[model samples]
Target: MQTMRPNPSRSDHKAIALMYLAFFVLGLVGSMTGPLVPALRHIFALDFRQAMAAQWLVLVVIGALAWPAARLMQSWGVFRLLCLALGLMAAGCLAVSFAAGSGYFASVLLALAVIATGTTLLQVAGNPLTTALGAPEKSHARLALAQGFNSLGVLGGVHLGSSLMLGQDAAQGVQLTYGILAVLTLAGLAMFLCGGKAFPTSALANETAAPSEALTSRWAWAGAAAIALYVGAEGAIGSIMINFLHQPHVLNLPMAEAGRASAKIYWGGALAGRFAGSWLLTRYRAPRLLGLMAALACALCLTVAVTQGPMAGYAALAIGLCNAIMFPTIFSLTLARSKAPASAVSGLLCTAIAGGALISILVGEMADHTGLAQAFLVPLVAYGLIALFAALKPAIWPQG
Candidate 1:
């Protein structure tokens, strides 16, 4: 394997700033699914599970494309790959904007799949690159800080999607919102092109480990499982928030109003917690903090399951706070403890995000069959398992 040394003249801070910007755009575009669910269902006349297929398809594309994206990053270089991903995302957004007026459900799904493909490439490159830009020991904290920006994007995306897509003229709203996103994505791509010379290119070099090698490390598998559950639980809850809030027994708000409420309380809580978690991770062990948050999230899901009115609604929203640190912490912890090639491990970890596709379907089914409140049990179990993973002592492995 060849190791590339960093150029002393290159600025790590510039690279980090670019990465944070990329994440922010990712959050903005990626978060539209939850808020769009009601509009999709109404337009397509879909049942709960069918409506959730939009989220499921995006996640499935992520899982399916992750490994290939990792391999592409190795050969193409992170900078070039990021540029390509951003361009692809722009194209996808434009496609979605155009398709919104077509009245064909499949066209929308196809456009989302294109967007998900771009998002997969971004995630496969972005997470590890962010960690590599800083001190190795501070990987968790650095990632958490970056994710805070992502949550900020989610906050804006949620509100924009709710206000635009949930209104009386849903099709026009979808067209305008995604048209704006395409422009923003193109702007991000321009920034990367203009600032390319300042990036620490050497920091993102990958080891030439075969994909199969990552499977040998127990930490890789453990981390993959945790990532899957974390994403699944988060996606399921977010996708259902508007509908759940509209339940007569819960908040009983109108659909459009409920979308706005979910955006502020649910994703907004995540925006707050990630900043706090970033600071806390600097002082506490990543595993301990992860376990604690997972337990708290599990308890909150239980509360939502058994309660009603504002209590249940608020309890559901509060899980976003617990979710704030999980993806970054679990990712960095696994990277720290695994001896596998970083690229291979990252590919496996990203692939595990397919769990969102599976888990969200289960949540949708439960909502259709039993009740939306009872559907909380699925993620409740997922969180319990994640807490168990966090509590286990880290296995000794040589650091890369």
Candidate 2:
């Protein structure tokens, strides 16, 4: 699994194709959990915090390990690491299929953490590998196209996993779904392993450039904080959406209905908004557009927190649309302002993913103490801060 060399061969193209498949598979598996929050609570007989932890522990592991595993990808080739990641994911799925009893919830979470570790490694190896796949000029384009498959996967994962795994006999359904996912992962592993000469390791050291100044800029740190908040808010909102949507005061929808809406309305908004944000950003200032979206998201969060009914549910779901372009915008914005190199800025941003874990715990606690409605405040303030950052972009950023 050496670094890829210049003038990628036909095999390199195959590897890239399969890599998109890998992304899709990862998304499919990840989406299955959020919609199951209520069912998970009942099956495991756990409190709100523990049930949330059951789903969130994986994110914590990903945040903790993604960066370190990325560094390890230098010593180990990207392809090899990807294989390891998929293998571990398959192993976790298999473990879940077997660990079906009431008390085995902890074991299931541990398995999920293993899967998360694999996923983090896959992302670390996969993103850069896309850039290395072919011509340097087309790297961003290639990555964007590959990411589209990820959205499709998410849509499919939630909708499909919910239909199959959230039935009356949930334990058996979960077992069967996990079993199938295990099989699919193994199939992906086979494809990558057979990608002979597709990802042969070549020199990557010279390819990465790091400017020292970006690390020193205060705005770089600010941008990183915004990223943390953004990711945290996204994950926090998404994790609670199923339960929230099912609340008597919220939408009061059935689990399956809530799950479908979560996938279609929530995740779908992200898919559509990415396309819309691209055009909107082209017509407007980046910072200004970011600010506008964040403010809208903030308003929606407040609406959701204070109101009750279907409209409020939709408002909550609409936040995903606002989130669509944020990560790319924030990443680019931070890079623009930082004296640090693009690579360094990227590394710093990944650390912010830990926000998903920390913020979830905070929101979970809030929900336990108060109610889900009030827990909305956590992300509400987070989006407000992001809006503020976007509005103050000129003052906080260096003047060229």
Candidate 3:
């Protein structure tokens, strides 16, 4: 592994700013296709299962690749790794554009999976980088702030992509959308390469611990499971919100309007809550905060499931606020207890992102069978589990 020696006297502000910028852009890239999921489903005449599967495929690839990617980040400098990932994102977008334009839905979906692979790699590298950018005691807060920027990116992505691609046929509006994303990713890549040497590397290197060591930590494995459930529930709610609103008993809003609502109102709550949690973490204990958030999330999900009309839909949106801090809080807490293998342990936790794909798909399945409102129940289970972990702080991390 390359040794990272920072010049303590030099200003790291520029490097930190650039790193956050990279994270924000990654968020945008990940979310740009969100509102378009339903549109793509319609364009390809896919069923609910198939559409959900498409999204799942992307997440599964990301989860599968996260640990290996983390090792690569340690081997390569953060800048080079970030740039390469961004380039992959751009290329994936371009590839998807061609696939969509050429009328190959499967190929387009696969291309999207490729894009997610890049985004996942960037996220795995970026989180720890941001934590190292500031004081160790407040690393959790800094990470939350960084994630807040990620939320902003998601907001921007939804608006831009919706305006360009939401209502159009797959080929008509998608090409331009992907083109714009490709350009953004390319720009990010160039900037990262230009300033690659400035950012500091994290000290929690996993090179010493064999991959099996990461798997051996029970807390890490439990944490990974927690993350998976959390993401699955979050993704399911976020991804299907528009569709749910379109149902007869729910918001019954126009598709475009509902998409906007999901992005701005739903994710907007997530953004605000994360920023607030960043500050709050300075004053409170991690386990306590996580437990409270998890409980609130459970209540909100229940409310959404039982209520009807805009009230229920809005409640679902509000749940985003409760969810905002859970990921980072759980992450920091899990790593804090790891004896000497945080990096590898972190890798195990990251793999839980597969929950996003699986949980969301289950929600979609329920929506298909029962009603859109009932899908909220799927996330209810995940939130309850997170709450359990918060209270118990279990040790179930896996070994290689």
Top-TM-score candidate index? 1
Q: Which pairs of residues collide in candidate 1?
A: none
Find the number of clashing residue pairs for candidate 3. Answer: 12
- lDDT values for all models: 0.88, 0.73, 0.76
lDDT of 3 by residue, 110-211 (tens): 888889888877877776566655567887787788888888888888777666666746467777888888998898888877876676544434344543
Q: Write the per-residue lDDT of candidate 1 for residues 1-400, one digit (tens) a residue.
A: 1232343234777888999999999999999988778888878788898989888889889998889998898888888889999999999999999988999999999999999999999998888888887676677888999999999999899899999998898888889999999999999999999998866667756566655677888888999999999998998899999999998999999888888888898999998999999999999988899999999999999999999999999999999999999999999888877888777888889999987788899999999999999999999999999998888785343333
Q: Rank the candidates by lDDT, best first.
A: 1, 3, 2
- Worst 10 contiguous positions by lDDT, candidate 2: 205-214
- Could you give me the TM-score of model 1 versus the true structure? 0.96
Tens-place lDDT digits, model 2, residues 1-400: 1133468788778878988888888877766667555557767777778878855687677767755775666567666788898999899888877775545787778878878888878876676566567764444345545655666677887787677666787777777878888998899888877774566565344324332233576666787788778877887787788888989888998887888899898888876776566566556667887888899898898998888998789999998888876765675566555655444445556655676677778888988898887888999888898887787655655632
Q: Give the residue spans of candidate 3 off by over 4 A.
A: 1-11, 201-207, 393-400
Error of 3 at 117 (Å): 1.8
Error of 3 at 51 (Å): 0.7
Q: Give the true-structure RMSD of model 2.
A: 3.9
| TM-scores of the models, in the order given | 0.96, 0.85, 0.92
